[model samples]
Target: MPQMMPINWIFSLFMFIMIFIMFNMLNYYISIIKMNNKMNNNNFLLKKNNWKW
Candidate 1:
């Protein structure tokens, strides 16, 4: 007898996983961007106030 796994099932699972990974990557990038913006703003403010590292 042929194995019972359906082709559509496997394809759907792969698609779901790919979408999930993409979402996670997008979320990670957004967080990084937010942090970078915050850091840049702080640096700018500090420079305006004559602060140094």
Candidate 2:
């Protein structure tokens, strides 16, 4: 039973690290998508204003 303890600890640590990395990647992509949307909206507004003139 004692020999199995270290293995469990290592596995738990690995799982935690993997989860953290996945969360960070998701956040990064979300921010990038938000920036892209903002850029697209700005371009759309600019085109609309030009047409009004």
Candidate 3:
């Protein structure tokens, strides 16, 4: 049991780091998607306004 302790610790640390990185990546992509959506919406609004003129 004592010998397995270090291995378990290393595995847990690795998993934690991986999860953290994945979480950051998800947030980064989500923000990028949101920005794209906002830009599309703005373009649509501008087109609509131009038609009015």
Candidate 3 wrong stretches, greater than 4 Å: 51-53
23: Cα error in model 2, Å: 0.5
Q: Tell me the number of clashing residue pairs for each predicted model.
A: 0, 0, 0
Tens digits of per-residue lDDT, candidate 1, 1-53, equal 24656777899999999999999999999999999999999999988898467
**1 against 2, candidate with superior lDDT:** 2
The per-model lDDT (C-alpha) reads 0.92, 0.97, 0.96
lDDT computed for candidate 1: 0.92
The order by descending lDDT is 2, 3, 1
Q: Report the poorest 10 consecutive residues by lDDT, candidate 1.
A: 1-10
Candidate 3's residue-wise lDDT over 1-53, tens digit each? 79999999999999999999999999999999999999999999998887543
lDDT of 2 at 16: 100
Between candidates 1 and 3, which one is better according to lDDT? 3
Candidate 1 to truth, TM: 0.75
Best by TM-score: 3
Candidate 2 lDDT (Cα, whole model)? 0.97
